[model samples]
Target chain A: MGTEIRVQQDDFSVADEYQQLAQESSCGAVVTFAGLVRELAEGQLDAMTLEHYPGMTEQVLADLVAQARGRWQLGQVTLIHRVGRLALNDQIVFVGVAAPHRKAAFEAAMFIMDFLKTQAPFWKQEHTTDGSYWVAAKDTDQAAATAWQDD
Target chain B: MVKVKFFAALRERLQCAELDIDSQPSDSVAEIRHRLLQQHPSWRRELLDNDVLCAKNFTFVDLQAAVNPGDELAFFPPVTGG
Candidate 1:
C-alpha cells in the first residue's frame, strides 16, 4: 500500500530496500531488480556519469509507479535511481515490488522498468580511456516500452 | 519570458545549460526553438536535429505544442536509463 521513489546521487542498498518491501505482511511475493555499470569490451573504462532533470525525474518515476499500481494489485513498491559518477560495478538503479502473488509482482516490476527506460529523464555518459561519450538510446529499449502497449 | 534548459550531451554541445527567452502566448515549441536559433545562430545544427527531444513544463510535447511565458521548457537527446 506504499510506494517509494527516489532519484539520488547516493548509492542504495538492495537488501535494505527488500526489507522495506517485505514489511507489508499481506504480501507473499517480493521481486527486485538492480542495474549496474559494466566495463566496456572495446577499451579500458573510467566511470559512468548519470545526469537527470531534477523536478521532472521524480515526477516521471512516480507516474510510472502509479501506472504500475493501476494495472496490478501491488502492495509496496520501491524504486531508486542514482545520479552522479559511478564506478564500474556500482549499483545504478533498483526496483522492488511486493504482491500477494508472484505474477503481479513480476509483471509490475517489469512494467515500471520498461516505461522508465524510455520515459524517465535520466541520461548516462560513459567515460572510457580514450574519451567520454553519451550513451545512445537503443531501439530495443523503445521496442520494449512499446510492447507493453499491446498488453 | 520562458525558461529553457538543456541536459546531458546536448548541454555540452551547445555550451549552454539554461537560457531565458522572450515568448508570446501564441508561440509554439517550434517557434521558441526558432527564436533561440535566431539569437544564437550557432545552435541551429544541434537544435534542428530530428532526434532532439523537447518537453514543455516537464511533459514531453511535440514541436507544435503551444507555450507561454513562465513555462519551463527542456531540450535534450533521447533518454538512456533503466
Candidate 2:
C-alpha cells in the first residue's frame, strides 16, 4: 500500500487524480471524497482563509494515512487539503482510497475523512461584509470522530 | 528551550505565532501553559478556553504530556478542517 498527502494553496485537478488512481488496475475499487466551501448561513462571503500549523498539518495528515493503511487493505491513498484564500464553492479537501475491494476502499476513505475533521490541525476563518471570524468546530464533528472508536 | 506555537483564532487573539521559552526536562504541557499564563496574563481568557487543544512534537497530546528541551509545543482552538 502507498500513501500521498499534500497541503498546498493551489487547486488540484480531480480528473488527473482519478486517472492516476485508476492506473493501478489490480485495485478493483477506488473511493474519493471532496469537500467544498459553501455560501450559506452568513449570506454571500467575501472569501474563506484557511490557516494551518505548517509542520503539524502535514504530520497529522500523514499520520491519518498511516492509520488508514493499518485498518484496511489499502493500495494507494491520496489526501489533499487546500490552504490560503478560497472562494465560495471552492474545493477544500480531497480523500481518495484505492483497495482490492469496495469495502476496504470505502471504509478507509471514510475513516480518513472522519479523523481529518477533528484530528487535523487546520482552521478556517470566513470573511463576510459583517467581518471575519474563525469558524467554530462543531460538536457533531467530534461525535462523528468519536463514533469511529467503537468500530 | 521549548518552541511553542499557536494557531487559528488563538493565534489571532494572542497576536503571536511562535515563542521560545526556557523549560525544564520534567516540564509538562500544562506546566508550560501555566507559565505562559503567568507571563501573559492578558491571554488567560483566550488561552484558557475550554476547547483549546494542544500538541507536542506534531502529535495530539494531553496536558500531562511531558516536554523536554527542544520539543515543539503547540496550542490552538479545536480544529475546524474537514
Candidate 3:
C-alpha cells in the first residue's frame, strides 16, 4: 500500500525491511536486493565516498519507483540507499518489492535496480592510499538499463 | 534566470554546486553551456565531455532542450548509482 524510500548515511537492517514488507497481507512474494561496497581493484581501495544531488535524489527515486509500480501489480517497494563514506563490504543499497505473484515481484525489483543504476543522481568516489577518484559509469550498466526500454 | 547545477566529479572539477545563469525560456540548454564555457574556459572540456548528461527541471534532457525562467538545469557525469 505504501512505498518507502530513504536516502541516508546510516546503515539499514535488511531483516527489519523484509519483516515490514512481509506483513503486508495479500502479498505472496517479496524480492529484495542488497548492494555492497566491494574492492575496486583487488584491495586497492580503502573506502568509497558517495555524493548525491540532495534535492533531486529523492525526486528521481520516487519517479523510478512509480514507473515500476505502473508496470506491475506491486504491493510495496522499499528502497534505501546510503551516502557518505562506506567501508569495504558495507551495504550500499537495498531494493525490496512485494507482489501477489513471484514473477511480478522479481521483475519489478530488477527493473527498479536497473533504472536506479543509470537514472539515480548519486555518485561514488573510490578512496585509496594514493588518493581518491570518482567512479565512472560503466558501459555494462548502460547496456543493462537500455535493455529495459523494450517490452 | 535559470538555476544551473553540477554534480559528482564534474562538480569537484568545477568547484561549484549551483549557479544562476541569466537566460530566457527560449534559451536552449546548449546555449547555456556555451555561455558557461565562455565565462569559465577551464570547464570547457569537462562540461563538453562525451559522458556528461543534462537534466532540465528534474528530468533528463538533451543539450538542445529549451529552458524557461526558474527552471532547474543540472549537468553531471553519467550516473553510477545503484
Candidate 4:
C-alpha cells in the first residue's frame, strides 16, 4: 500500500523485506530482487566502496519507483540500496514489488532495477589486489534501460 | 551563484567536491560549463568527455538546459548502481 525506499550503509534482510511486501493481502504476487557484490576476478577483490549523492540519490530512486507505478498496477514497492564499503558477496540492493498478478509484479521489479542501474546517483569503486578503480558504466546496462523505453 | 557539485571519479579527477560560481538566470548548463573550463582550464577533459552526465536540481538535463541563480548543478560519470 506504500512505497518504502532506503539508502543506507547497513545491509538489508531479504526475508524481512519479502514479508513486508506480502503484508498486502490484496496482492497475491510478490517479486523481489537482491544484488550482491561479486569478485571481478577470483580472489582479486578486496572490497568495494559505494558513493552516492545523498539528497539526489534518494530523489532519483523515488522518481524511479514512481515511474514504475505509473506503468504498472503495483500495490506496494520496496527499494533498498546500501552505500559505503562492502566486502565481496555482500548484499548491495533490494527491490520488491507486490501486485495482483505475477506479470505486473515481475515486470515492475525488473523495471525498477533497470532504471535504477543507470539513473540512480550511486557509483561503485572496486578495490582489488591490483588496485582500486571506479567501475565503468556498462553498455549492457544502458541497453537494458533503453529497451524499456520502447514500451 | 549556482552551486555546482561533482561526484565520484569526476570529483577525484577535479579534486573538488563542490563549488559556487557567479551565474545569471539566463545561463544554460553549457554556458556554466564553458565558464568553469575557462576558469579551471584543467577540468576540460573530465567535464567535456562524452560520457559525463549532468543534472540540474537533482534531475538529469542536457547542456542546453537553462539554469537560474541558486540552482544546484551536478556533474558525474554515468552511474553504475543497480
Candidate 5:
C-alpha cells in the first residue's frame, strides 16, 4: 500500500507530488486530480467560505486515503485540502494515487472525492452579491457513498 | 441521546450549535426535525426553502432514514461544495 498525508493552507503542486508518489519502478501509472474554486457554485456565488471541523476533518480525510490504499496497490496516495477564508482562483483540494496500472490510479482518485464530498464534515459558505449561503451536504452525495459499500 | 450540529445559514437561523435530542423509540430524521421546530421557531424557517439539505452521521440523508440513540444528525442548506 502507498499513501502520503498533509494539511496545508497553501496550495500543493500535483505534478511535484505525483513525481514522488510514482517514483518506484514497479508503479506504472499515477493519477492526480485538483479541485479549484469556481466563480459560480450551484448557480450562485459572489463569495464562498469553506468550513471544516478542526480535528475531525483531518481524521476523515486521512481515513479516506487509507481506504483507497486498501483497494489498490502500487506506490502512494496524497490528499491535500485547504481550510480558512479562500477566494476565487484558489486551489481547494488535491488527490493523487499511484498504482501498478492506470485504471486503479484513475478510479481511486475519483472515488475518494465523491466520498469526501458527503462524508467529510467540511461545509461551504457562499456570499453572493445579494446574499451569502452555506453549502450543506446533499442526498446525492450520500447515495454516492453508499455505492462504495459494495466495492 | 445524540448531539446534532448546525452550520452556515441553518446555524444562523437556529442561532446555536450542538442540539441535544433525547432518544425516542421512533425518532427519525424527519421526526426529529419536526420536534426540533417545536423547540425553536426558527428551525422551521429553512424548510420553507425548496432545497434545504440534511445529513445523518455527517453524510447526506434522505427521507427513508431514521435517527436512533447516539446517531449524529445534521441539517443545513443545499450544498454548494465543489
Candidate 6:
C-alpha cells in the first residue's frame, strides 16, 4: 500500500527519496543504505562492468523485497540498482525501507540487501591490476542466503 | 525471434556464447538447455550446477516454460553484481 518496492537503473536522489518515504503518518523511522562501487575487490578492482539477465534482475529484486515484506511489517520499500560500466566510487545500489519503527526498517533493509548480494541475477567483471576476472560468488554471500531459508 | 547470447564467465569456458536456436513449435527452456548440452557438454558443468543462470531472449527463465522456435536461448553463470 506504500510507494515502495521499486527497482530501476536510472539515477535516483536519496535525499528526495528519504523525504518522500518519511512523509507518511504511519511511519516512525526510515532506514536506507547507499552502496558505492569500490575501486578494489580482493585488491584488484580498477573498474568494473556489470551485466545482468535483464528480465530476471528486477524480478529477483522484487522477490527479495517481497520476502522482506513478509518477514517484517514494513510500510514501503525502495530498491534501486544501477547497471552498465561504473567508475570507482560510483553509486551502485540503494536499499531503503520504512516501517512504524526503526528496528523493522533497519532489519528489513539489511535483510533485503543481504539477499540481493547473493540471490539477484546481476554479475560483474572486475577490472584489475593483474588481469580482469569475473567476480565469483563468495562464501559469505552463500551463507547469507541461508537467512531466508523457510525450511 | 530474438537472438540469444551469453557473456563473461559463461563465454570464457564455452568459447562461444551464442547460437541460432531454430525454435521448435513447442520448445521450452528445458529443451533448449538439453540441446545445448548435447552440442557442448562442457556447458553441463555450468548449467546444472545450481549456480548458473538461463535467459530466453535476454530474460531469465524457468526451464519448464515454453519458448519460441525462432527465439534464442542463452545459458550463463549466476550473476555477481554489487
Listed per model, the TM-scores of chain A against the true chain A are 0.98, 0.97, 0.97, 0.98, 0.87, 0.88
lDDT of 1 by residue, A49-102 (tens): 999999999989999999999899999999999999999999999999999999
TM-score per prediction, in order, is 0.98, 0.97, 0.96, 0.98, 0.70, 0.79
Of candidates 2 and 1, the better by DockQ:
2
lDDT of 5 at B29: 78
Off by over 4 Å in 3: none
Write down the TM-score for model 2.
0.97
DockQ of candidate 1 against the true complex? 0.88
Off by over 4 Å in 1: none
lDDT by residue for model 1 over B33-56, one digit each (tens)?
999999999999999989999999
Model 2: residues >4 Å from true position, as ranges? none
lDDT of 5: 0.73
Candidate 4's displacement at residue B13, Å, is 0.6
- Per-candidate clashes come to 1, 0, 0, 0, 4, 4
lDDT string, candidate 2, A1-151, tens digits: 5688999999998888887777787899999899999996748688999998888899999998898888888888999999999999999999888899999999999989989999999999999988898998999998988998998
As a whole number from 0 to 100, the lDDT of residue A4 in candidate 2 is 86
Q: Which residue pairs collide, candidate 6?
A: A5-A77, A123-B80, B23-B69, B24-B69
Which candidate number maximizes DockQ? 2
Report the C-alpha lDDT of model 3 over B1-82, residue by residue, as the tens digit: 9899999888889999999989966899999999899889999889999889898888889988988889999999988877
Span of ten consecutive residues with least summed lDDT in model 5 chain A? A40-49
**What level of docking quality does candidate 4 show?**
high
Which of the CAPRI classes, incorrect, acceptable, medium or high, describes model 2? Answer: high
